[model samples]
Each structure stands twice: as structure tokens, then as C-alpha cells.
Target: MIWLLLLLSAILGAIAFVAGRRLATRRAVGQSAHSRPGYHGAYAMIWALAPALLVVIVLLVFGGPVKNTMMESGSPAAVSALEPFEREAFLADAERVAAGAEPLQIWEGELAPALRSEGARAHRIESTISGAGVLAVVLLGLLGGLIALSRLRPNLRARNRVEGWIFGLLFACAAVAIITTIGIIASLAWDSFRFFQAVPIAEFLFGTQWSPQIAIRADQVGSSGAFGAVPLFAGTFLIMLIAMAVAAPIGLMSAIYLSEYAGSLTRAVVKPVLEVLAGVPTVVYGFFAALTVGPTLRVAFNDLGALLAGGPLDGIGQYLMLVQNQMALTAGGVMGIMLIPFVSSLSDDILNAVPQSLRDGSYAMGATQSETIARVLMPAALPGVAGALLLAVSRAIGETMIVTMAAGLAANLTLNPLDTVTTVTVQIVTLLTGDQEFDSAKTLSAFGLGLTLFAATLVLNIVAQRIVKAYREQYD
Candidate 1:
């Protein structure tokens, strides 16, 4: 019904716009107007639609509450005698009975006939109110259109007014974005404060242990939880390092080749093919890591370990024997594959944006293509490239699905890529999964992890911005 009202309002506004244009055109047949016919039409349309829409929105928002109040006031003495909560439930049943649906809870006695009577009365009142609201909207819209049409003259500044409105709208959108970011940060900080009160901030930030389990009863085994987050941070850092190590060179090289070396046809074909990797869901990459890469790595490492077990390098072999299917190496390598398109696409755009004159000048100086690209192009595009890599690192650090699937959730404080490990994001998910009491340290710990992650990402962004600004200034 609301959508129908809006549609009718739009049609009425359009008709008014056409009528306003005709009026302005007839007036202009005698003398030149200050603005175009379209501007006069738009001015009329805005006047006609804006107030009518605003009124309709208000009516729609408040209509239900008003209807409920009227129904409760008209409700029978028996119905009103019920408790407040029970009265609400009884009204719900009455509404159902009025609508001809079977009442789920309310059945039997004088309640049934009384509810039916009240429900029918409420429905009739709602219909009457709705009809009046629509009539009021139409009248207001017509009044606004008539006023705007009468005011339209040779000197009216409709175009300027319209442009100002548009500018204000755009500014409002930007303000909304800024406000939303502040809201998110404020929420995280508040919950993190609550969490810190329960667990020491020093222990969370600096302790090496990563256990988060808090037993409800002292008799429970392994319930003495440790909240040291160092291991999770270390694991996160190690995986991000491995992912970047794989992504940076390959993605950058691919971007360079696509932009500088590949022919038009090859660039068109190869760029999209590489970008297709980006569209492939992370869960698919997770599956690839878990089912294919993880197993392959484990078997290869185990075989290599067995082959070297009798040799002088026995200790290294023994270490290799402990390599598992799900480990940091598997997750990081797969995650790197997922990040390639982000790096390649951003780097390609940045490299392409470099002034053609710069490359021409470098070539004119008797520098070879390789030398020109290595020294001039790379330096000029370094800032954008740095920004892209920073984004990728942030992405890598926050990834949960690939880490959860490819890397086992053992919060081991080790640097070895072959051993199972977990990231802060993975731990955060684990800590909050399923039914949880928010007051418990176990659940609140997720907020702590999230706040820490947000802080770390913010710091990285700030540092990257400074570096990019420096390089960009030098190049410019």
C-alpha cells in the first residue's frame, strides 16, 4: 500500500511537471524567460513531490502506533482487564481473527466475539485514516504545484535552486559515510573497554599464551583460560608475510607485463583472466587449500622427511615429519592466490596512470625499456603501488574463511609455516561462535580482538599514507 501511494505520487508529480512546462512555454511565447522550460518543470516537480512524500512518510511511520492506540482504547472491559503483556497478545489474536486467519493462542468464551468486534472496528478505522492521509497528500501536492506554477516568472532562479539542492544531497551522503565509520569505531572501543575491565590489557596485548576459555565451574578440566594474544598476533603476522611474499612479486610482475609488455589483445585477455581469480569466492580458495594444497604439501614434506631420516640431517627430517595438512603455509599460499588480482589490478591502473611523457623522456635519454621501467616508472608509481599493497595486507590480516579452513585452529606460538597455527581473526570467530553470554570473557574477547585488529589496520593505513605522500611529492 505504501509503495502504491509512492507510485501514484510520482505519476502525479510527473503530470504536474509537464503541465508546469506547458504553462511556462505559453508564458514565454510573449516574452523570453530567465530559465529553460525544463528547469521550471523540475522546480514544479520538486515542490509537488517533496512535501507530499514527506507527509506520506510521516503518516506511514506513525499510522501503526496510532491505530494500535485507537484499538486499545476501544477494546472491551474484559480485554482491558488483562495484564499489559497479555493485552498485547490478545490484540494480536484479535487482529488475526479480523483478518480471517485462525487465532493461534486465543480461543474460546466471550473473548472470541468481543475480539472479532474490536478487530473489525479497528480495521475500519485504519482504512478511514489511510484514505484521509492519501486525500491530504493529493491536496497538498496540488497546492504546492499551483503555488510553484503561479510563482514561475521571467526572473525565477529555478536552476540555481535545483543545483543547490543537489549539492546538499551529495554533501549529506558524504556525511553519512563519515558518521557510519565513527559509529563503528565507537562501538568497538566501548565493547573493548568492557572486555579490558575483565581481562588485563597488558596480558591481552603482551602475554604469549592464547587460550580464551573461561570455565563456569572450577571443577572443569582445562577451563583455566589464558588470554595472552601474542601467539595469535604472531600467527597472523607470519601468514600475512607469507601471503605478501607470494602476492607482491607475482602480482606486481603480472601487472608490469600486462601494462608494459603485453600486446593489446594479450592484455585484454590476460587481465580479465587474472581478475577472474578475484571474483572466485574465498571459500572456494579455502576448499582448494584444504583438499588439494594442504594434503599435497603434507605428503611431499612427509616423504622428504622419510628420505632424509637416516642421513646426517636427521633432526631436520624429524622436524619435517611433524608437518600437517592444515598449516600456515597452506592457508597463506592460498590466500596469496586470492590477493593477486587486487594487487595486479591496482598496480596496473597506477602504472598506466604514469605520464606518457615521462616514459618518452626516459627513452629519449638513451635508456632501454627495462632501465626506464626499473628507474622512472616504478619510482613514479610507487605511492599507488604501496597503497595497493597496504590494502592487500589489511585484507590478508582480516581474512577468516581461508585461515579457518586451511590452517588448523591451534594457537601455537611458532614461526614454522609447516606447523598448524591460528590468526587473530580465526580466534575471534572461534570465541564468538554459537550461543554465548556476552558478559563472559570468552564472548567479550571477540570484541577485544576486533578492536585490536581495527587499531593495527588504522596504524598501518596512517604509516602507508605518510610513505605514499612522501613518494608522491618527490615524483610530482
Candidate 2:
């Protein structure tokens, strides 16, 4: 029914548009017009559509609540005497029965007959209200169109009015984005504050241990949860460091080759191939890390350990035998592979954006192609490159699936790439998974981790902006 109403409204809007254009044409024939026929038509269409759409929205928003209110008012005395939760559940079940869906068998009261009668009444009321709403929309739309047509004189600045509306809409969209970011930060901070009340901020930040298992019952063992997040932070940084180590040099080198040295055909082919890595799902990378890279590294390292044990490093070799499938190296190396496209694409664009005149001047100064690229173009694009690296680091920090699958869930503080570790994001996911009470410190700690991650990323962005600004000013 709503869709049918929308179809009719669209037809009316089209008719109003044509009528408005004809009216504008008549006015132009008689006198000089302020706006074109098309502008007048657009103005009429806006008048015809906006009010009717708003009425439909309002009716849809209020319709269910109003119908529910009617049901409650007409409900049987026995149904009304039930608890609030029970009554709500009974009404929901009654609604399902009325709609011929599976009936909930929870309600066993003597109010079945009353409920059936109320459901019938509710259905009639809903249909009547919907029909009235649709009629109001159509009538109001026609009225708006007629009024707009009446106002369509040679002097009416319909174009300016329409443009003003469009500008307002654009501003509203921008405001929504800003407001949403602010809302997210505010929510995280509020919950983080609640978490801090349960766990001291100092301990969470500086303590070495990180065990977030909380016991619900007093008799439960191993419930002594620790909220120290230092290990998670350490693991996050270790993996990020390793990822950047792999990504930065390789990505920058690839960018340099593609932007400066590679032939046109080579650049065209290779750039897209590099970017395809970015399009591949992170879960696929996680699978590769866990199933392929992790095992490969373990075997390689184990062999190296055995060789060393036969040599002078027997003590270190014994420890190296403990190296397992899932470790920081496995996760970081794969994540770096995942991040190559981000660095390469952004760096390639930045390097290419450098003026050709700079390269020409370098050549004039008798610099070789390699020397000019290394000393001139690269230095010029350093700020942008730095920003790209920072973004990649941020990406690495927030990654959960790859780390969870390949880096193992142990929140070890060690910097060893061979050691199993976990990140803040992984821990956040772990804490929030499964059925849990939000009021507990364990669940609330996810918000704290979120807030910390937000702050770290915010800091990275601020620093990157400053660096970019400084370098940009130098080049300008």
C-alpha cells in the first residue's frame, strides 16, 4: 500500500512538473521571467514531493506506536492486569497470531478471546490510519503543487530558492558526519570512564599482566581478572613495527619504480596488480598467514635452530625449539603484505604529483635519473610518504582477524617476532564475544581499549598533518 502511494505521488509530481513548465512558458511569453522554465518546473516538483514525503515519514514513524496504544486501551481487563513485560510479550504474540505468523505459546491466560477481538480491532485501526495517511499525503501534495503553480510569476526567484535548499541539504550532510564522529567519541569516553571506576587507570596503563577473565559466581575458579593493558599495547606496537618494517621500504621502492623508472606499460600493469593485493579480503590474508606463512616460518626457524644447536649456540637453540606456528612474525609479515597497496598507491600518487619541472631542473643540474629520484623527488614527496606510512601503521594497529588467527591470543609483552602475541583490537573482540554482562569490568574494558585506540590514531593523524604541513610549506 505504501509503495502504491509512492507510485501515485511520483505520477502527481511529474504532472505538476509539466504543468509548472507550461505555466512558466506562458509567463515568459507574456513578460520577462526571472528564472527558466526548467527552474520553475524543479521548484514545483520540490513543492509537490517534499511535503508529501515528510507526511509519509511522520505517519510511518508514529503508526506502530499509535496502533499499539489503541490495542492497550481496548485490551481485556485480565491482559491489562498482567505484569508490564508479560503484557508486552502477550501483545507481541497476539500480533503474530493476527498476522498468521507462528503464535507464541507462552501466553496461557483466560484473555484469548479478548486478545483475538483486540487484534481484529487493531488491524482495522491500522488499515484505516494508513489509508487516511495516504489520502492526506496525496491531498497535501496536490495542494502544494497548486499553490506553487499560483506563485509561479515572472518575478518569482524559484532558481535561487531551489539552490538555497540544495545548499542547506549539503550543509546538513556535512553536519551529520561531524556529529556522528563526536557521538562515537562521547560514547566511548563515557563507558571508558565507567570502566576506570572499576579498574584503576594507572594499573591498566602501566601494569605488565593482562588477563580479563571475570568470574560471575563466587564459587567459580580463575575469576581473578586483571585489566592491565600494557601487554596488549606492546603486542600492538611490535606487530605494527614489524609490518611497517616490511611495508615501508618495499612499498616506497615499488612506488619509486612505478612512478619514475617503470615503462608506461609496466606501470600500467604493475600498479593495478599491486592494488589487487588491497582488494583481497583480510581474512584471506589471515588464512594464508595461519595455514601457510606461519608453518613455513616455524619450519625454517626450527631448522636454523637445529643447525645452530650443532654449532656454538646450543643454549639458544634449545629455546628456539619452542617457536610455534602462530607468532608475531607470521601475523606482521602477512599484514604488511596486506598493507603494501595502501602505501604503494598513496606514495605513487604523491610522487607522481611532484612537478615535472623539478625532474627537468635535476637533469639540467647533471644529476643521473637514480640520483635525481633519490635526492630530489623522494625528498619532495617525503611528507606524503610519511602520511601514507602512518595510515598503514594505523591499519595494522586496528587489524583483528589476522592477528587473532596468526598471532595467537596470548597477550605477551615480548618484542620477539617469533613469540606468540595479541593486540588491543583482538583483546577487544575477545572481551565482547559471547553472552556477557556489559556492567562487568571485562566487557567495559573493550570501550577503554577502543578509547585508547582512538586516542592513539588521533595523535598519529595530528602528527602526520603537522609533518605534511611543514613539508608542503617548504615545497610551496
Candidate 3:
């Protein structure tokens, strides 16, 4: 259905484009005041597309909730958790009555008519929006085209005005992406606020414990759920540190090799191969970390005397030992591997983007490639490299699957990399993955963690940008 709608919209836009052009051509040859044939075409295209697109937006926003409410309100269980045969008979009778036939079927046919009527009404409403939109576009296009054509005289200028409108439209389109990001952040903040209301902000921010199991029955026994976020935060930081430790050097080295050393042919092959890493699924990485890397590390660590000869390594081992099996080191290692391509690609771009003249000037001073790169290129690219590192750190912090699968679920409020720990992202996923009361502190705790994560990332980004600006000014 969505594809069909998109196809129709594209077709309508093309038609509007052609129609607008034809109308413009028919007017005085060089006459246009506010816009040209192309501008009019685009204006018409927007009009043609807006209505159907709005319909889609409205439908998506309300459709699921409305449908769920409708289905729930009609209590199927109350009627009977009926036997299959009985349900079939009921449906059959309903269909007969709905068709206005004699009551030969088991279910009432009146329900069928009602459903059909509602479906028809929805279709009519959608069709009306589409039809009106298309008509409005055609009319507006014709009027605008005529006015533009009339104003386009030998001495009159239309191109500048047309360009201004074009720029405005392009700017608005670009702003949509930024606006969407802001909207998402706002939503996260709102949810986090709700979470803080349920759990004391202090406990969430500074508490050392981290469990989130609620009783399923009145007599079920378990530890009281802990809302302290320290463990998750510690786990996340541990993993992030490990990941950055791995990714940073590898990526920076790769970037240096690519920008300063690799031949064009080598770059052509190597760059794409490196990029393929980014496309690999996080789930694939998770499985690799959990099933392969985690066990391998355990065995290796045990051999190296990190674990006792006969003891099973359990939960966050850094500062606390609550659950066994999570090793922050493993999760962090895999996460770093996952982040390598992200850092390498970005660093490569910045390295390459460093002005050629800087290198030339160094070479002119009889500096070798290595020395020129070290003294000039590295300094020049430092700002961009710092930005890339910050970006990598942000990504590592928010990463979910590998840490969740390999890092262990137990939050350990410690900084040791060897200890198994959970992160805010991992906790959020664990907390909300299944059925839960929305009002519960456990659920709200996820929001609190999310809010903290947001603030941390925001601060990091600001700091990175400021550092980059300062670096750039130094070079200038």
C-alpha cells in the first residue's frame, strides 16, 4: 500500500511538472516575474505530493492505536473463547445478516455491513484529500505560470526571484532532518522525566545496585529491584573505554596509511573493504562476541591466571560480583571492532581533506613524507580526527547488542575492564524488552538512564565541537 501511494505521488509530480512547463512555454517567450518553468514545476510538484503524504502521516499516527482500541473494546473473550467450530458458525451467520440475506449463517451479517461502511468512509476521505490536492496543484500551477510568463518581458528579471524561492524550498527540505532529530530528543527527555518521577533521581544517578525483576505472583521471591544506575553506567564506560582503546589506534593507523601511504589502487580496494564492516549487522557482531569472543576470552584469561583454575567467572568482576558470566572486556573488545570502520572512514576523510599546500610547503622545505605528515598533516587533521573519535565514543556508548549479549546483564559499579557489567543502553533494552507496567519504577528507570545517556552524549558533542574549533583557529 505504501509503495503504491508513493508511486502515485511520483506520477502526479511528473504530470504537474510537465503541465507547468507547457503552460509557461505558451506564455510570452521570455516573460516570468517570480519564478521560471522549473520553479513552477517544483511548486506544483509539492502541491501534488503534500495531500497524499499528509494522508499517510495521519494514518500512521492514529491507525494502530485506533485499531487496537476498536478490537479490544469488542471483547472476544466475553463472547466466548469459543471452540473453532462454534466460531466458524458464528462468523457465517454474521456474514449472512450483513449481506441482507436470510439468517442462514451462525453470525449476524449486520457486522459485515458496518465494517464495509467504515472501510468505504475511510477510502472516501483518503480519495477526497488526494483529489483536492491534485486539483489545487493544477489550478495554482496554471495561475502562477501565467503570472510569471506575463512578467517575463525583455527588460524584466524573473530568474533572481525564482532562485530565491528555490533556495527557500531547499532550505526547508534540509531543515526537516534536523527538526526530526530534535523531536526525537524531546521525546526521550519527556520519557526520562517520567522515569525520574518514579525512581528517586539520586538513586538513579548514584546508586550502586542494578536489578530490575518484578514479582509475577504474590508469593514469588526475588531481590528487591534496584534503581541505582551506577552499575550500568560503569559497565557502559568500561566497554566504551575498551572499544575506544581498540578502535582508536586501529582506525587512526588505517587512516594514516590510506591518506599518506596507500597507492590509488590500494585505496580503491582497501577503502571499500573497510566500509563493508559498517554494513555487517550488529546482531552478527553480538553473536560473535557472545558465542565466540566471550568464551575465547574466558579460556584465554583463565590460562593467563586472570581467573582461578577451577572457578567459573561470573557477573561484573571489576568492583562487584553479583552475576557470573559477563565480562566487560569481551563486550568492549567486540564493540571496538564494530566501531573501527566508523572511525577509520571518518578519519580518512579528514586526513585526505587536509590542504595539499600544507604538504607541498613542507616538502618544499626538504621535509620527507613521514616528517611532513607528522608535523603538518597530523596537526592540520587533528581537529577532524578528534571529531571522529568523539563520534566513535558516542557510538560505542549507545551500542546495544554486543554489550547486552556479551557484556553481561549485571550492573557493576566499578571501572575495571575485566569485570562483567551492564551499560545504560543494555539496561534500557533489558528493562523494556518484555511486558511491564508503564507506571513501575523499573520501567521508568530505563527513561532515567536514557536521559543521562542523552546528556552525556550532548556534552561530549559540544566539547568535541569546541575542541575542533579551537584546533582550527590554531591552524588558521
TM-scores, each model vs. reference: 0.88, 0.91, 0.74
Top TM-score prediction, candidate number:
2
How many residue pairs in model 2 have overlapping backbones?
0
Name the runs in model 1 displaced over 4 angstroms: 59-133, 216-225, 473-476
Local accuracy of candidate 2 as per-residue lDDT tens digits, 1-476: 67766876788789889999998998888688889998899889888987888777887789789888988888888989989998898888777766767557644558767667666776688688878878988898999899999999888998998898789889999999999999999999999999999999998899788878856876554276778889999999999999999999899999999998899999989999899999998899999999999999989888878877866898778767778999999999999999999999999999999999899999999999999998999889989999999999999999999999999999888999999999999999998899889898889999999999999999999999998888773543
Reference-based lDDT, each prediction:
0.88, 0.89, 0.71
Error of 3 at 417 (Å): 2.9
Model 1, residue 471: displacement in angstroms? 1.0
lDDT of 3 by residue, 247-353 (tens): 99999999999988999999999999998989999999999998888777766655545343334633323223232345888888888988999899999999888
Better of 1 and 3 by TM-score: 1
Better of 1 and 2 by TM-score: 2
TM-score of 3: 0.74
Which residue runs does candidate 3 get wrong by more than 4 Å? 1-13, 29-179, 215-224, 306-326, 364-366, 473-476
Q: What's the lDDT for candidate 2?
A: 0.89
Candidate 2 accuracy as TM-score: 0.91
Candidate 1 lDDT over 1-476, as tens digits, reads 57666876798799779988888888888786888888889889888887789778888898889889988898888889889998898888777776778777854587778877877886787688778778877888888888889988867887887678788879989999999999999988888999899889998999888767766777663276678999999999999999999999999999999989999999989999999999999999999999999999999999999988979999989888878899999999999999999999999999999989999999999999999999999999999999999999999999999999999899999999888899999988898789889887778889999999999999999999998879874434
